[model samples]
Target: MSFVLGVISALTAPFLVVVGFIVWDNHWNGTAFALNMYNCTMTAIGFLIVSIVVRQFVLEPSTEEEIFTSQKIGGLMVSSTIGILIGDWVWLEGLRLLGSRKIIVVDSLKPFLAVFLGEVFLDERLERGAIIGLILTVLGVALVGLEKEDHNIETETTIECESVGAAGTEVFNEHTVLIEKDNNEQSSTVVVDSYAQQRKNRGKQSTKEFIYGLVMAILNVVLHTFGVLLTKKYGVGMTTFEINLIRFGFAGICMALLSFSLWSISNISSTTTSTTTTMTTMMTTMTMKPAWYLLPDASYSTWRRISFGVVFVSFLQPALTNYAMFQISLALLLTLESIGPLYSLPLSYILQGNRPTFRACIGAILAVIGIIVLSFKGITES
Candidate 1:
């Protein structure tokens, strides 16, 4: 069920994000900064809400001074924020442009990149097997990106009827119908040639987006690795829940401030033409209304759904994963995370009825193998 939630969160969170950006872009010309800030702020809100609810109902609450005063906690907060901000923004961007499946596969490169970073930054020596594993991992990701997108599978339904004629002769009639149910949705009939052409065009666009997503995924992996390292280094004394709370709280505050500043600047610049306009804009801005930050064109229902997705993806997934992290070694944590694609791919098939191409499956296997090799090496060295 957790794995299913992870898959659902991965797909749904980004979809809502892409939709929010699309609506914002169409209406108010949204910037990437705004989108990043929005995501961070909302994520922070989700964490805070959960924390408060848990503290009130399930656990005793601790003082902010106790959590924030320690030097180690402060270091963890800063380092984790750097990692979370960069990794999250890049990941969301990848999701927005490339889609969930492709982005998830691309993210499997993290362990490989982390190994390389370790060799460079920590002066760690990589075993020959680890080096070979790294090579295989890169090759697998390349193959995945290069594999052709699967075509829509159509299901044909046939019906036959027979009737006896007045002259005692048997009359037969037959009917055939073709229906394509994609992702559990029935699609309207489309001409084969035209559909093929459309798919080809879409494939080209998807290829371009995949390349872009690949780069972003790599950057995300690097930043996320750094963040994890920072947490491991400075997070020895604190509980995982406390560290996460501080991280989220600090990050949320920073993003909220940045977002408010940007919003103010943009509004001020736009409203400089007339005193009346300035006054009205100032009043609207001073109110610190959600409408100023959120998409004006988006409906209440859209906001509610997006908020729910953000809560699940941002809060619940991380809470579960972080709790698990406290119980395991970093290498084991990473090795487990590296299997995200394996879960995502199969779950997509079961839930959406979208089958992966053969090449994709092979690529996922190779990447998993590479991560396992790296994990084994780390375990032995430690």
Candidate 2:
């Protein structure tokens, strides 16, 4: 049941992130920095609460080596925080730009990237199956890109204008044209307005944003690969709960200090607009009730759901995933993680009644085959 829960948690983790960001984006128009900070802070608080409760009831003491005084553990915490912070920020930014589906597909490159990173940094030997898996993973990513391109083509809007007295019709595809009809100026005006509307619709497809998202997605893979390697090397003698508490607690403090500093600067800048008393009140409200002040207004139920989702995703998911990480090699672990989309496909189908596209199905199958081959190699070598 624990293993089953871990697998379920792993499969649904991305969806939870996607849903949280979508809700926040829709309601609060939240920045990635704000969301990341809130998530870290909440996770830290949750871990602290759980730790206090467990300490009161359970008396499992840590060894001297497990104490937090060691320089090695300190370095691990610093490096891990950097990796998690940057990785999560860029990942949310990617989701903002590319949406959940595209970002998730792009994330499939993680295992392939991790394989190379492990070989270089961890002195892990790449087996023949890993090499083959890398090829298939790349191929699968390419197919996903193709699907995106097809989606773009399908979304492209074309306007066909048949002028009243003109000999031929003029067609415009995502571009403006000054069409002057011989007899009907009103008709020409209508065509121009229609073309303007089409342009407005097409403006939503931003090539620059898509490219930025793609780069961020790739950077996330690189950072996460390094993080996993660091954890496998230096995460010895620490409980998962201890790791989460320390890492998130440190990050939460840093983020709080940064937020306060920014708020102070902003208050100083706007001092002329408001009296000192009003400024102090504003600052107090922001500090004492940050979430209520910063986040968008929603119903109590909505806020409750959002809070629950964040706790599950930010705290529980990592705890379960870290357990699985300890049980497998970094390379094999990442290879298995690549099958997340395959799990998501069926889950999405069952829950949302959304069918997978043919290309997505093909990509999922390829990724699964690669994972199976890689896992088989790992077992045989062991």
TM-score of each: 0.56, 0.66
The lDDT values for all models are 0.49, 0.54
Alpha carbon deviation, residue 298, candidate 1 (Å): 3.0
TM-score of 2: 0.66
lDDT per residue as tens, model 2, 103-200: 55666666667667766766666677766865675456446434433333243321212111121122110010112222223443454454444434
- Which portions of model 2 show Cα errors greater than 4 Å? 1-29, 51-64, 91-109, 130-218, 274-293, 379-382
- Top candidate when judged by lDDT against the true structure: 2
The candidate that achieves the highest TM-score relative to the unseen native structure: 2
